[model samples]
Target: MNEMGKTDTVVQPQSSLLELKKMFFLYLPVCIGGYIVFRVLIVLPLWFSSSTEQLSVLRIIFIILGVGALAVVVLGAVRAPRWVEKPIHVHYRHWAPAFFATLVILGSIGGHLVASAKINSNLALEKVKAHFEKETAEYKMGRNAQ
Candidate 1:
């Protein structure tokens, strides 16, 4: 007979799949999301910009906006939407571990994109600006001579 004050509690160990789900949710949102967010919030805006002649104020503004997007994504562990949650629930049985492992193998490419966006975008623009300016100067000299 069990006493009213005593209760036996049963605890089940988490499966390996759950561990993979945990890890996938942990890194995917903030890291990959941050990279994707950068592409959207920063790089996309600059893509068609005409005045990329300098490391101007707009670049900084977009970077700050990207950071804001990254901040929102960082909370993904707690409150992802149903569209995303449904996949985790459905895939946990079969694909969660393999998917997580694949992400682990491929994660660095996204990281490199983020890093390259921050480092290379402005430099590339500046290079283009310099080449254009040189051509303009040469054209001006030829026109003046004629």
Candidate 2:
């Protein structure tokens, strides 16, 4: 105020809080809905299958982490509108974008892990079948020679 020689009005913190709260309230439903849909339509079915046990524990861990990432994405969507309302000097606000980005990256990695695990398992099965066929053919040829 002294620099400008003008009166400086104090901003009410409650106004900021209220705006954030309203944004969260509005965003929460959409986030929750998406979370529920993803769990039901995607994660649950994949995890529930008995065949999933053939996957490595690390793959399962990645899937769990992906679920957590999805949760964070929902949370970020909820908070994003409020952050856009006014610029604040809080560290959390500064970190929000990074946090959201990490969530997306983690989720993508997890998804890739799950898919690769499945593909590797299928390839292994095919290799085993080929080896068995080759051994059978060799045994049959030896018997014919005898």
Best TM-score among the predictions, by candidate number: 2
Q: How many pairs of residues collide in each model?
A: 0, 0
Please give the lDDT score at residue 36 for candidate 2: 54
- Please give the distance, in angstroms, between residue 140's alpha carbon in candidate 1 and its true position after superposition: 13
- Expressed as tens digits, the lDDT of each residue in 1-146 for candidate 2 is 75889888987665667657765655555455544543443343255433534444445556666667667656666655465566343434544444554544454464545556675777788899999999999999999999
> How high is each candidate's TM-score?
0.29, 0.43
TM-score for candidate 1, please give it: 0.29
Candidates in order have lDDT scores of 0.51, 0.57
Q: Which candidate is the best by lDDT?
A: 2
lDDT by residue (1-146, candidate 1, tens digit) is: 25877776775566768867875676566456544543454344335444443334445554554454444445443344454444444443334334333333233334334445644776788899999999999999999999
- Worst-scoring 10-residue span by lDDT in model 1: 100-109
**Candidate 2 — which pairs collide?**
none
